[model samples]
Target: MDAQVSINDSQAVLRLGSRFDFKAHREFRDAVESLLGQAGSRNLQVDLAEVTYLDSSALGMLLMLRDKAKATNKDVALVGVKGSVKQVLDIANFSKLFSIA
Candidate 1:
């Protein structure tokens, strides 16, 4: 798993690659935390276009991220989800808890 983070005053984007599982925990958490730490960064867009797979742990990670984001007054959006990644999120009904694009 790989994560690339980009942030600005208006928005923050985290681009994920390949598998998104527990292996991504530390990097994902760091990226999100860095973005949330920035002043005026109220929106976080998680780019899933390059992600091909995800496990239940990934869902838990997302939920944790959401909780942290909420605590920091930030909103999270998952973007470019497709194939198995999309299916898993759909099955988990994450759209109800996040903004999926």
Candidate 2:
């Protein structure tokens, strides 16, 4: 599973192509944190359309991103969510904490 990230306009988009599990947690967090650090823009977006699997660690990462964005006075948005990823977010009531598009 590979996690790729890109930036466009004011948004930092993360495309996850693998199961977001504990094994990838460290790399995922490091990559995201590095990008967030480099992102001078004010908006962040996590593209979960291709994420076939997700777990609590994924949710924790999202929360961490939200917290980091909030601390930086920026906005974080979750986009392109579907299937199990969407279900997890919905079941966890994360839509209330994040702006989903």
Q: Rate the local accuracy (lDDT) of all candidates.
A: 0.90, 0.81
Task: Give candidate 2's TM-score.
Answer: 0.90
**CA displacement after TM-score superposition, residue 53 of candidate 2 (Å):** 0.7
- Estimate, for each residue in 14-61, the C-alpha lDDT of model 2 and write its tens digit: 777768878878877877786677656678787777778999988998
Error of 2 at 32 (Å): 1.5
Model 2: residues >4 Å from true position, as ranges? none
TM-score of each: 0.95, 0.90
Q: Indicate the worst ten consecutive residues by lDDT in candidate 2.
A: 32-41
Best by lDDT: 1
